[model samples]
Target: KTTTAALIEITTTTATTTKTTTTTTITTTTTTTTATTTTTTTTTTTTTTSTSTTKAPIFNVNMLNNGDAETGPCETDSNVMNPPGWTCNGEITQLAYNNTFIYSRVNTIPGTAPGGCLFYGQISGYTSMWQTIDLTNYADPSLIDTGTVEFNLSAWLGGFINQNDRAGVSVTFLNQANQTTGSVTNIGPVTDTDRGSVTSFLFRQATGFVPVGARSATVLVYIIRAAGNVNDGYVDNVNIFMYQ
Candidate 1:
């Protein structure tokens, strides 16, 4: 029994042991962003200038060609009434006085006229000087339609010291049918009354208006020698003006 009790105590003396272990975990995070940009540019420029356009109408006017008779017929001057741009309704002869050729009363003697080289016109018989002004396209028809336009006609006429010759000037406004739209007449600027009264000269002026629907103006400058060639008259510096 004693042996048996000793073996039981030895068996009870057997022991048991226990052990524990721990583990740790770690984490890391990161973020990134990218951007792009662009730009543009522009440019500009400017300039300026000046001009002239305010002159009066009187200084700048001419409806017909060669109205001044400066060119053609002669190198210097002539008495032939058949000038360019003008129709010779009749014939005239070139008459010279004191060595000055009769173109329009160019004085042969110095200090006689405004200029020594004056022109003398010898109109014989029933000869006439005629021209046409084309108002159909160039004129301000609106002004004429309202009877507000005026045509001014003028001329320098003279007598050869005791000449019985007389001349007359007239203007006729015509329609497209060639009919009279308006007219102005100074029939006998004759020897005693209008012309040849002075050694200098006479200036006669007539004014008229363009009738509505008129397209043209026909100018007639004529001379009448009452009896013989002694009726020969002179004319010079014919002018026509149009305005208000």
Candidate 2:
């Protein structure tokens, strides 16, 4: 953030005047033939002035991955799991191998089976899976900066039958007092790939319907598997930035 100041000026002016007179003593001695006259004038003036100016404050916050333990998530339960102004809900586990976090939604939604909306990983030639996490813990509509909420996200989806499966992130706005202000969702599907690797996804707050009196907000990223077969996705490098 940055700030600057300016100067102003003012000016004024004024004027004034005076008067005088003459007597008739000679007219008294000369009786009938004498006369007298008198006259006066005056002027006054003044001036005044003043000056003033104004300035603004700057604020910024960056949630990015830079390999720093304090700024990146490398393992489950890592000290950097949830930084300031953020929280996690549900069964979200951070993986140490690639510094990625996985959320499972299995069994949480009705009709969903063993790994309904969850992520599964290889376990000794077998497989391990868990349920999805709720975004409410990460985003509070009331805390979002109504003017600047942008998400620079990326993920990877390994070979699976559900290639058309949808997955994405969501953001909620909150007021300065930390109350729910509004909510919006960003949805998309992962592109099918033979080998798993990082893929990019970007989500920003919509132009219209921004929250009122909101100073900040929360963002939640999810790898959704739109109802279908048991398809799992890998996610990484989720970046959050706020404009000044």
Candidate 3:
């Protein structure tokens, strides 16, 4: 009986229980960039100019080295005419038979001792004579550019013994068209003497003459015999220049 009661109490007891839960977290990052630009420039410049040229004179008459003779109707003898290489183009007889020539002459006339040759013509009938030479072909006005003309004259009135025989010389400018541009008179009448056979006269005068629409110009020489009664006068050493 005691053994049966102990087995029944041992069959008596056992018990068990379970539960689960979850959670999560996150992080982020960012980046930025920038750019710049530049520019350049340049410049330039230029210039210009002009020029000109000149030429020389063509004709020059130096009455030096007497080599001319006289030819005209004024004197009773052939001695009244201009020398060779010259011409008798003025009045046949006026104011004691005036004679003239170009380049050279004998410079003789009785009572007119030391006669001055007429390089240019004379104004017919007038007490004084006026003559002109053609300088058209010689001067190139266009090529002249610029310059000055000059000359020298020495006259002896009466055989260098007296100053009674009066005379004068002048300079004139001419154009290609054979026209007068300007003139300078009374440059000389300087009395000469046998002892002082020649008096010096200088002409550095400016022509200040221009040719109208012409490509050339000329220098004219005029000799005037004023006194009707006197010994012959003489002219020597004529020259000219282009100043430019």
**lDDT ranking from best to worst?**
1, 2, 3
Q: Candidate 2, residues 1-244: lDDT per residue as tens digits?
A: 5666555555555555555556657544555855665555555555555543222222133333321113334344222232222344432333443222332222122221122122222111222121222222333443333443333322222223334333444555566566776665343334443223222222222233444555544555444443344334433334344432
lDDT of 1 at 211: 79
Candidate 1 local Cα displacement, residue 66, angstroms: 4.2
Could you say which candidate leads in TM-score?
1
Query: What's the TM-score of each model vs. the native?
Result: 0.59, 0.36, 0.38
Q: What range of 10 consecutive residues in model 3 has the weakest lDDT sum?
A: 94-103
| Pairs in steric clash, model 1 | 104-119, 104-120, 105-118, 105-119, 105-120, 106-118, 106-119, 106-120, 107-118
| C-alpha lDDT of all candidate models, in order | 0.55, 0.35, 0.35
The candidate that wins on lDDT is 1
**Candidate 1 lDDT score relative to the true structure:** 0.55
Consecutive 10-residue window with the lowest summed lDDT within model 2 = 122-131
lDDT of 3 by residue, 1-244 (tens): 5666455556545544454445555555555555555555555555555554333455445332232123332333323333233323332222122433311223333333233333222332222323344433444455442433333333322222333233344555555565555444334454443325432222222333333343323323234444443223433333333332
Identify the runs in model 2 with alpha carbons over 4 angstroms from their true place: 1-61, 64-86, 96-166, 182-212, 225-231
